[model samples]
Target: MRLISRLNPAEGVGDFWAYIRRPQPYRWPILGLSMLMTGTLLFWVLQERYYLPPERPQVTYITTFAPGRTDEEIIASNIANEARKDALAAEQAERDEIRREIYRTFGRAAGMDVEKIEREAAAERAREEAAEKARREALIGESIAEPAE
Candidate 1:
């Protein structure tokens, strides 16, 4: 009641309804500020960086060769390199076998024929297409004559 009395009715009969009907001085500036803040907030949120975990850690190696290497050392190093090559080839073969076994296991679990699936399915697809073509031709075939005019 004290607050209501303090409001000036003398200021152009500025009652509650009139005050509400009147244009707000700060409306557009407040709206613009609010929109700018929201836009900046959304921009910051959408453009934020996200780091993903790597599948494997990066590996780096630094190698140096001696200038005064002997013949015996060179021959031993060559033999070691040859042994490393054979080990690498064996590792690759074992990895391939393991991959095939994994695929076979999964295929069996899924009730799928892993080995014969690709080749036999291709053959079956070709047969099915030929059968469908023959069926369509038989329905609208040269062998079947048109009705008499």
Candidate 2:
């Protein structure tokens, strides 16, 4: 019973209310400082957890060259680099295709028109590309047009 009385939040709130009701010279300042501190802490936590952009993985390109390397060796190295890059691109394409297939399977399972969705996406891409091409041509024409003298 003693422990429960001591630990009761209502009693604690009553005591706090009595203390706050008493005359105090620094009460306003204390309240303001506490509010500011609380706001700063809340903002810091929210910014750290939600507002900050996620860090992306860095891409590092590695290349090797030496003064003593012959022309043939340099050419072979260039060819190997190109082949590796092409292989990576092909692997990425395969992964993308597999991912699309999985998405299509899920969409079909959910009774979605997967083919219609794909066609719409393709049409959207085409429209965007056309708009971009038109914008580029307009800019080029403006640049090439003779200025009014």
Candidate 3:
């Protein structure tokens, strides 16, 4: 406190502020201008909150082949499909992983819960089988109709 008082301005150092203390002719106009500016800023902020738009939704679709085809044929038709998916999933998982590693690479990259991923993959496979079954049924629709005994 003693050190701060030593740095204070002297009693007789009056200058600009002394002359401005009296009610000048322009004081009312200056005060009104300041109030107008403050009100305009508040109005703009309130208007902005009401006028903003909502977020848009994002959607994606992935196409897959029908099942019942030979393993070789299916693999050939979609050679890099599994690899591509694995690579992307692995990359996303790496971003989420806390540890840097070599041996756990596949697990780290595949970030999904093992059981959940397996279930989803199985469901996808079943859908493919169902699609193939429907295709076959459509092809054989009237050809194998029963004859009267």
Candidate 4:
């Protein structure tokens, strides 16, 4: 279009420079605000790149099955895997408990009410567990109900 062809970078640049040169009472404040906005925008845009950790690669668990495997062998393998997972989970929980006890000991020595904090944490965990149980029960009830004809 003729309108688009008439637009020139030289004219825009000159106008911008003219505006910047023109003295106004609020010019400094406006410039400060603009700089602040630019800095904030740059920070917001680059935060994940600089502040946060890099993304982790996806984990893949490979299970190789032979050409012909017996049902008992498969079942035993599954049971063993489940038992191993459970043991690892239990070990992790124990380690966490031990760490918490150490922290509580240090906190008490520092005159902090670790016992009160522990009690509050325990109550919150109980509430979360109860909620999870309710949700599980609701899902189970839905699955058990017969479909209407």
Candidate 5:
């Protein structure tokens, strides 16, 4: 019963409540010091680091046409030149892709027979050229036979 009374809340609850209600004098200073230390550490870390400046953007300008050229002509020439360059680049890329595809497709078997392949390709090209010539000749004959408009 004595050990139970020492452990019970109803027996010592008044003293416990009184101790909790008492004010502690060091609480404000401890809280203030902790806040000051945190602020100082944050300031030191932010100020000691090296920060790089933002990079400037690159700007490109095309060359102006010579004097006496109209605005429309200059614009048209610029558009045409750009189009031609783009088309040439596209064609070169397509040719490179075709060459790569052909090499990949035939690289295994073409190790020793590359010359034979070339010969066959040449013969095929010759046959196509002959057929085109015949077609052109037939067209010329038809034109010659037609009456004058």
Candidate 6:
């Protein structure tokens, strides 16, 4: 506060304060200009906030629904009825296929031959996994050592 008072003398009025007390010729014009600007800002704010905007929507969304319809409301109504029809039909078809397969006695059932083949596949997979692990570890070791060097 003292610093600000230093710019204008404590004893006498400053130039700006003096000019404000005894106005110049263009003071009324400046005041009018400020009032005009404030009115313009107020008008713009009222138009934007209080008044309704134009009905200009994006092209993709314009075709989706009517004016009053929202995407969420449409989806919420359709989710339990129309959307589940196709899904339920597909699920029933899958269950029927599984039921038919369980009744059939022609195909190879779960037995020793299947176990033997599975064991061989698992052994092969383990070997491939160990090789891949060794290769990845070697690459990682090389990467780490190169940075240090």
* TM-score of every candidate: 0.33, 0.46, 0.24, 0.46, 0.30, 0.23
As for candidate 5, its clashing pairs are none
Comparing 2 with 6 on TM-score, the higher-scoring candidate is 2
Candidate models: Cα lDDT each: 0.83, 0.91, 0.72, 0.89, 0.81, 0.73
Candidate 6 lDDT: 0.73
Residue 108 of model 1 has an lDDT of 92
Model 4 misplaced regions, further than 4 Å: 1-63, 135-149
Residue-level lDDT of model 2, residues 1-149, one tens digit each, is 99887788998899999998999999889989999999999998887444768789898876566768999998999999999999999999999999999999999999999999999999999999999978986877645375735
Superior by lDDT: candidate 1 or candidate 3: 1
lDDT of 5 at 120: 85
Candidate 3 local accuracy as lDDT? 0.72
Which candidate achieves the best lDDT against the true structure? 2
Q: How many clashes in each structure? A: 0, 0, 1, 0, 0, 0
Q: What lDDT is reached at residue 81 by model 2?
A: 95
Output the worst ten-in-a-row residue range by lDDT, candidate 1. 140-149
Number of the candidate with higher TM-score, 5 or 6: 5
Per-residue lDDT tens digits of candidate 1, residues 1-149? 89986775776565655665669998668779989999999998899687998679688766576768899999999999999999999999999889978988999999997879767867999999999988987797754465534
Instruction: Estimate the lDDT of model 5.
Output: 0.81
For candidate 4, write residues 9-122 as lDDT tens digits: 888999988998898889889999999999999999888644677789899877588848999999999999999999999999999999998999999999999989989989
The CA lDDT at 90 in model 1 is: 100
How do these models rank on TM-score, best leading? 4, 2, 1, 5, 3, 6
Better of 2 and 6 by lDDT: 2
